[model samples]
Target: MALLDIKGIDVSYGKSLTVKNCSIALDPAKICSVVGESGSGKTTVIRAVLGLLPGGGSVTAGDIVYENRSLLKLSKGEWRSLRGRDISMIFQDSGAMMNQTRLIGKSFVEYIRTHESISKQDAWKKGAEMLGRMRLPDPDRIMNSYPFQLSGGMRQRVGIAMGMTYQPRLLLADEPTSALDVTTQAQIVRQMMELRDEYGTSIIIVTHDIGVAAYMADHVVVMKDGRIEDQGERGYILNDSTNAYTRKLIKAVPSLGGKRYV
Candidate 1:
């Protein structure tokens, strides 16, 4: 069975409809990418799956089913229990999401304790180990540092480490590599693919970069004007799709030495 099924969902913010008739079914241990320009509702689709729609926004049609359970119906307590343990999200600017005043370890420990009853020392140790797994050198020093002290790539790795701490069955990443340089973006993408290989985690990545989507996704979903313009397996989306918008987006990818990266 599919791990997550988003069935024809429509989302609205107050009276303004932002996402319409969107559906995606993701299988276990696979990566799916939703790509589009800004405001195309890519983020909204994943946020709906995570049940973290901003206040005044709600799913108005269809349903989101994770592990055959309806996420739309989960109570607050249920959501709290499920969020970090079974599913986790990495934001676009992970450093910006952290508390500027707190050390990385402090925030990480608090996050761990929120979902588990471990002691502070144990949580700190675990957080450091996770950071090490992300390949950050000198995990101890990193733990002692604040988010501001780390480079953008390091901060992104820290976010990925935290999200992967529990080996969540599903990982939602929203433009995770957008803020970094070309080299760092490549590193982060490779690391995320490695996480999927190591943990058998299914991933839903929302991005605007078609090249990134082509490089990582097993399935590709193209969104335009709050709707899915085209979707298919990677091969089909990259080569067989005849949709005008999809073709336009693919053509926009930059080329180097006369070879298009995608």
Candidate 2:
């Protein structure tokens, strides 16, 4: 069975519908990219998967099944038990997601304890270990520093480390690299790929950059105006697209390494 199955979903803000009849699935140890322009309802899908959509944004139809259970039907308490341990998300702006008043080490340690009944010292050690895995130098200093003290790249790394610390089965990344520089973006993407290689985590990424998608995704789903424009394997989306929207997106991305979007 697939690790994630989002079937025939319809989402809405107020009475207006977004993400109509959307369906996608991800297997273990794979990355799926959802690509689209701004306002194409990519964020809506991610929010729905995380069960965090607010302001009357409801799932009008369909269900999200992760690891064979329906997430849409899960109670609030169930979600609290499952979210950080079974699923985790890394957002676009990592620093913004953090608390400025607290040191990262303190918050990270607390997060670990919330999910597992581990000693505070053990949680701190685990947090430091994750930071090191992300290739951060001096994990202790980073843990001691406030969110604002770190660079954008460092902050994003911290977010990734924290999210992946529990080794969740599903990872939802919403424009995770959109806020980083080109070099940092490449580094983070490489780390994410390594995360999948090492832990076999299933990932869903929402992105506008086709280059990043092509580099990272095994399967790609293209969206436009709150609906799927096209979807297929990475090779198919790049080489045999029948839809104009997909072709346009392919042409917009710059060449990566030796691979061209043509």
The lDDT values for all models are 0.95, 0.92
Give the clashing pairs for model 1: none
Model 1: lowest-lDDT 10 consecutive positions: 253-262
Clashing residue pairs in all predictions, respectively, total 0, 0
Return the TM-score for each candidate structure: 0.97, 0.96
Candidate 2 positional error at 45, Å: 0.3
Candidate 1: residue 137 Cα off by (Å):
0.6
TM-score of model number 1? 0.97
Candidate 1 regions exceeding 4 Å error are: 259-262
lDDT of 1 at 33: 97
Predicted structure 1: clash tally: 0
